[model samples]
Target: MNTPSPARWRPNRYQIVTISLALAIALAFSVFAFQDFRQGQLAFRVFNDEIEVLTTLANIQRHQALMFAQTLAWLDDPAAGKTEIEKQRTFLASQLRVLRPLVANEPEIEQRINNLQAALQEYDRLVESLGESPSPQARATARPQLIELLRRVDEALVKRAYDAQERSFVLDFGNLLRNQERARALLFGVSIAFILLVLFASGLYLRSERNTFNLRQRQIQELQAAVNDRTRALELAAGVSQRIAAIREQSQIVVEVVEQLKQTFNYYHAHIYLFDENRENLLMVGGTGEVGKTLLERGHKIPRGRGLVGRAAETSQPVLVPDTVADPAWLPNPLLPETRAEVAVPIVVGNRVLGVLDVQNNQVGSLSELDVLLISTVADQVGIALENIRSNQVVERLLQEYQQLIETSPAAIGILDAQTGVFVQANPQMLEMFELTPADVGQVGPIMLSPERQPDGRLSQEAAIEHITLALQQGKNTFEWVHHTRSGREFRAEIHLTPAPNREGRPMLNAIITDITARYEAEQQARRRAERETALNRLTQAIQGALSVEEALQITARELGQVLGRKPVLAALQSTLLSYDKEDQ
Candidate 1:
């Protein structure tokens, strides 16, 4: 035999497809990951730019406020106004010197700043003119002109500020679009390259058909293991991603609906304040966490317009308090323990502030501008949800009160499904009268009160249920029955049953059982004794009237005394008188 021609085998369809597809997919993923990394970098840059813009805005607002305050102070100075006004001029020039360089390359911005400077000069002239007047009356004459100049300066400042704001918006929008486009292009290019690589791999797998049987077997096993591993990894990743997405969605919804946003501030406590449903008072809704629960139990209240949160609600403006510890506008919270930073945004719908959303941080500068923006987005969802939750609670509370009233009423009240012979409800009194506890009320059937059948030939438990069902269907009122307890005590009950309406508008039966066994027995005993007494009295009277006094007395004494256990006239009468006398005394 010519050394048996080495087994020549072609690649199986599954092996070729799986290997080629896996290789292509891996390559595609690598490319996609690179693109993703680049996109992440671009997003990070955009975020940084946003932060820078916010910082600039903060600085501008601070500087402008300070400048306005100084200008007002200078207008009040007689000497400074009459003379060179050296300090004021120097300050203005210094501010401009710094501002000028910032916009030097941007002609439009520079020109705008220069215009504001010219307006400020006009404002100074008007202030100086008022200062030169000799008397209050003369100064009053220039007051209108001074007011006009100040107004002009304000208008110019506001215009430039708004312009800068507009420019920032435009730049942000443009950069965002550019970043997205670039990421998309890179992703597309990589995807195409990955597809071509897969095609090449497939061709190679087909051409290299000769199989070393053992090696092929080993490769197949390895491939199967890799596929299993990849599948498991993908499943885990998908599960994690879904969970994260759900959390985000729920958080967003909660933030929108809740008023006076209840949030956990720390491990130990949470703070809840009232938010206006219609710009009224802050309302406390729900809170958890250890510290949060304590704060709510302590009855923390945020009066409208009292604190940062209240102010936001009252003014219908978002308030970001940088340092809660230092800001007087932040009402002190005993539970807060010097909260370092806080932001409150009004949750408004169509100009009506529904509630205030507040977020707190323990460390200074812990909350960034992005946090405030994100919180605001969440607040929009929270506002409606909060309102719905509150309304639901109110309705639920009212229903509970109604139920309580029914449960405690003197009437033995109970609800049952007549058809099923199931107890839907039972009052305390009803349960007690039946020797039942709350735990037993819902579980036991109506016929459970009857004796159960024992294995030792006692009454069958099933028989008692049949009796109860028959009685219920008959709608019998005032049916006398005796219940033999597990302790063998027989309790006679007079039960009354009536048709009860079910919650679903179905007919049900309510049976009221009254224990009348004692009463019935007592009444029977009294009637029997009364009949015996009547017979004896008649016999005694007949004997006294028909016979002589001596004989009649003797006979009456003997027969009546035997029955009554007493003498009629002397001894008994004396005893009765003495007893009455003693009782009277």
Candidate 2:
């Protein structure tokens, strides 16, 4: 009555023959497709090459026109235009050279390019001759000839060459289109034949598949399950990566990672234990739930290799215990008394293991190889986050030290945004020197600290920006600046602006300003003293060399008058009263 399960429906020879025919047709179609693709690619390459050649020729033509303009510009202002003319001439020559190679395949184009080069050389000779002319009259005479030569080159050489290349490109493009159409037709026929063969083969295949449909369906289901599990693992890794990356604190990263793992994977308990400085003990640093809090409060510690966490940390490897109760090394914690299975993955950075990420479940054998793999991946992310946090902490410490140093420094120091020319930070000494408050820090620009005009007669704002720009370009600048304070008191400042590395990795200007007014005044005093000494020496010499008392008095009076910037009257009591007033005499 069962009818032998519908004769078992075994495949016959017809199905095999149909499958062979289908495969052959498919192979033929594939070959046709490959040929068609290759033909299309060749057509594209040909079109691109043509376009490149046309573009090069066009660029050369444009440069030639620019060269002509520059030549005319030279006629207007020879001194300024000569340099630009020479540069344009050099560029045009280089373009000609580039075009020469591109058009080498076409004899007409190549000949045209050669003629163009010859014309360019003649033009350059004329320009050079014009430059060497002794007077503008001779240059004026040569201008007509230069213009004629430019017109001839532009029309005969560049224009003709472009037309030739364009015609060649059109012909090549037409041929390529025709070849592509032929390939497409052949591909279409082969594809149609392939589709019909495939349909016939599929009919046979469907008849054969009905007998083993249940078995194939089960296999598909298993494969889909595996795919879903892999997808889920990837999604979890992505989520954990994002969460940990945002956390820059080592302890916080650990805590967030553990909590995510427990919630995402529905593990009974999750804990993170970090290695102590001595690398001898694993201390619970972060965990999930009240159980985690209790363990953390108890300051639970385990020596290396003492339990799952310790083993993972010590070996820098993952450890899974399917049945903690059956494992000899399993150390049951009072907080997680119901834990039946445990997995530990090391949180490692480079060659060193920083900690272990442990997950526990209440069901025995609940953790599989996939669970271990996923948790281990998350542990790696946690390790990277820890490394980043440690690096940030180190940078923060260094920054604090630097800020303290700047604050205590005697020289006035300020940090200015290089782009905006605005002050971002100022030290105490800087604030006092500028007579500025902390509130004025960000509101001020480099010019605000300078007088209306500099000692050199340059506008202070313009000069400051110029020097700051120079510092940014060259990395440092040191100059004497006249700065006006809030009280309208002008003083000399020796400013050293250096490019400082900022937190955002951008270049900022560090202005180290030192008041040099007193030093300048002292220099002036020393000069004046030297001048006074010289004047006294000259007066003494003149008096000593005088012939008589009156002469000496006259000499002394004249010398004293010169030194004092006024006439002096010298009187002497002798046999007859001797007197000399240098201005009156």
Candidate 3:
């Protein structure tokens, strides 16, 4: 085996090419590394731009919120605030212009910009149509659109800032980029000198390197295999963690994860399979090359525990087949006949298996446990990326939906000062409940908003304070109280109170007032009906027990009067004659 062959000594295209292009490859790698340094430099620049973007966005949102305040101001004196509103709108537009270029690269943010513009236009039209003096209802309906404008501006900027912080790796490498600058010139000179020296030395060493090539071929190959496997795995793993972290779509993530695995490792095929709604099968969601396309088109899938991919997903672990031909569990596909080695790694998040990442090579014994671990690492990152995207989307959706719910809910909602129980702000339903305007909120006290006495003989102010105190102490409280509108209309309300976000160094409560007047009246009618039945039974028993007619008559009158809540009229045999006094129970 140690003896050298004449054929081995003969110059091959590989060695010749390696010999010829070694210097170029080295220089290119160096230059590429420099480009990476330049990339880090550029990242810093972009980060600075983002900070400015945040500032600009904040100003725009501030103007939007201020415009809302101005609308409230307009309610006070419409004629005086028109020019100021126009001026604020102009400033908002100018700030938006400044923001456009900064986020031009982001289509999502750009779309938000478009929405913000449309909302601004709608707001303008609505405000203009109010026509000098609008009804309280119209003005109330129109005031909150400005908040939507604020949300449009604030939501994107906040998300962008968070994403910017997360995606910016240059912060850690910023110091390293500076160090790279000093070495660049020296590297270029050494590289040139080394290239010239290598040509001369390589010519002499060709004979020696060739003679020893046969002796070292086995060792070189083994080392190269191990090195290549580690390198590809590390690169793929790093790419999953860094390069694709900014990708917000799970579909894109799955595709990129598998495609990069196939490309970087020179695998014959690579694919990602995700669980369907029922999770009984692994469906090919993403893959590489023509085989991947064919499989996806054919709607390829493997049932749980049926194949390597399925087994990986089912167990939430990896399955490796170094030689698929010898493996009894390997699933053969005619489209991927070149698969001689295979590996499948589960894409798991917590206890849930989302999918499997599968890759195959054409050469037998090409895949190994190291490949399994590396692929599994990539799979885990894929899981995290997908989960993060889902969580973020959920949170944003909930936030938007919550605002819409608060804006449009029919239940009377009001924000109150926890200490005094005075409404600081109220929704339309709350305003309608009290027949009060926005301006009346601060002026009205708990007792003024409600009747002086509760149905339970408790002071309205005292009961309100108790409820507010309980909510502040225990996070939430629910109770019933009687309230009177400004028009002296009394209605029964069931108030649910919860602690709200603190404002101005004081606690607050969100009061959800449900009108229970109808329900209360229905229950009271039912109670009276039951009481009348009980009293009739008792009166019958009393009449049966009475020995004298006069005693029976007196007992009948007393029972009738008690039941009717008034004096009973004496009738010979008809005991139904009764009258009710308006002022008496």
Candidate 4:
């Protein structure tokens, strides 16, 4: 009876179970409260992001309006407003690009963005048309359409932005209500368990604080890493850009670009696949490593839309494969067996896709969005460089062909400075005809090619200057002149002077010379022959009408002497000549 009365203050099993249940409920409520807080934080972050997107869209619309106003002003006064309009247009395009990523997940917004893009394109076309011919008719036809398209785009953006704002407000309000309910439940549970769980609550609070500190540290580290990666990407981009800028040849540019990409970015491999003349296949133009050499030897080609590189070129967009083996669009090459990731960016200039820049890595998810952006920029630069190189090559080839033709021409041609009347260039025929070398003719004035006096009784110096001036003013002149060679030999030449366009965009004189020395000699010989014939006829007629042979002989001698410009001796025939001939017979 005394032992039974000893445990009077001890609680029963049901009471202990009730207390345990309350503690459990309190702990569960605390966990739910933390989850709710986390969810609230996430919701707030999402709401803030949505607000930013809406703000950006609003800014884009404002910029579009500004651009429209500028365009109208430009249409009104093209010369005064063109620069401002272009500036506004460029700003609007940049803003639209900024807005593109923000609304990419919203279908309706994306559709509206697409429409805006199309409208902007149409506006650009109309603006270009107006610029080309700033006629009232063209403006009347294009301005209304442009204004309508701009208004539609503006309305679409504004509506989408308003809709997004409304959705964000609804989500925020719902999240707030849910958080308030969760907080009430958490407070009730905590009140029920506080009397029994002070020590437990203290321990849990300490653990949460430690976790928060750890999370903060981890976030700091991640932020630092991101900053470092961004800096590294920027440095790599700048270095590659500088290197690409220094290169002049297309093949050299491709090779340097691929090599830089591989070495700087530490990519597993880098390759450039350019479109062939037919544009049906992408041929490997430049690459790095032994796999590249093997591919080059094998003449590796990717058809349009066949693989990542091909797809990028076909679509003129970038293609990224985080895991090549898992991506259906990726085509594995035996030469690059270790490749786990790959990205192909189209090298485009304006509307032309010159090639595809393909880079790969040995690790999955090695490439980031930053990498894509940097590489895309590099691709654009490479495309521009390749276009410039091709254009320069074409110009050089044409210039070489023109120089060859000039050197091989049969006519004696020389180029003279229009301003100074000095010889700038001479063909081989011209140099040979003048018996002068290039060094001797260099910087020599046109008067150097002629004697002191010309056939037209003008001083050669004054005449050459006058002829150059006339050719420069009238575009062409042709006249015959007497000229002297380097060896002091004078010749009659037909000089043709024509104005020609030079490399400096200024006019130069092209002088073509024709020698008429042989023709002049032939004409003189024919005139002398005619005069001799006339003199002989006159002598014959005088002899026929003469009374005596002496008169006829005298007339004949005088005529022959006059024609020959010298004295002529005549011999008389005697009767003794016939007697000697008869005796011999």
Which prediction has the highest lDDT against the true structure? Answer: 2
Residue-level lDDT tens digits of model 1 in 78-105: 4445333444455556656665654565
Query: For candidate 3, which ten residues in a row score worst on lDDT?
Result: 575-584
Q: In each prediction, how many residue pairs overlap at the backbone (N, C-alpha, C within less than 3 A)?
A: 21, 0, 0, 0
- Our model 3 lands, by Cα RMSD against the true structure, at 22.5
Judging by TM-score against the true structure, name the best candidate.
2
**Regarding lDDT, does 3 or 4 come out ahead?**
4
Model 4 lDDT per residue over 202-283, tens place: 5675566456545644664665577567767866886797689678988789889989999888999999999899999999
Put down candidate 2 lDDT per residue, 1-585, tens digits, no spaces. 655655567668997887777778768867876886798788788767777777677657656665665665566457665776677678777777777777778899999888888888888776776753336644443444555566677778887987888788768766765665565466556545555655566767545544344454466466557756776776787688778878877767878888899888899999888888898899999889987888889898889988888888877889999999999988888767899999999987645688898999999999888888888768867866776566445445545655886899887888898777778899989999989889988888557767789878999878888998898776568999898888878999898887665536555777888899999999999998998899889988988899987777667767776677443343322322323344336
> How accurate locally, in lDDT, is each candidate?
0.55, 0.75, 0.72, 0.73
Question: What are the TM-scores, per candidate, against the unseen true structure?
Answer: 0.31, 0.57, 0.41, 0.49
What tens digits encode model 3's per-residue C-alpha lDDT throughout 1-585?
697756646667866766667666667657876886797687668767866665565456545655655665675466665877787889888987888888788676677677777778877887887877877545544444444444444455434543553344335344444544444445455445444545555766555545444444455456557655565666667776665667899878877887777776677888998888888888999888877888889999999888888888878778888999998999899887788999988887645688888989999998888878678767766876776676556445544654566669887887788876688878788888888888988767545768778878988777777777888787568888888888998889888777665676688777788889999999999999999999999999999999976678778877887777444335532443222222234
**How far is each candidate from the true structure, as Cα RMSD in Å?**
32.1, 22.3, 22.5, 21.9
Residue 27: error of model 2 in Å? Answer: 9.0
Error at 280, model 2, angstroms: 1.6
lDDT comparing candidate 3 with the true structure: 0.72
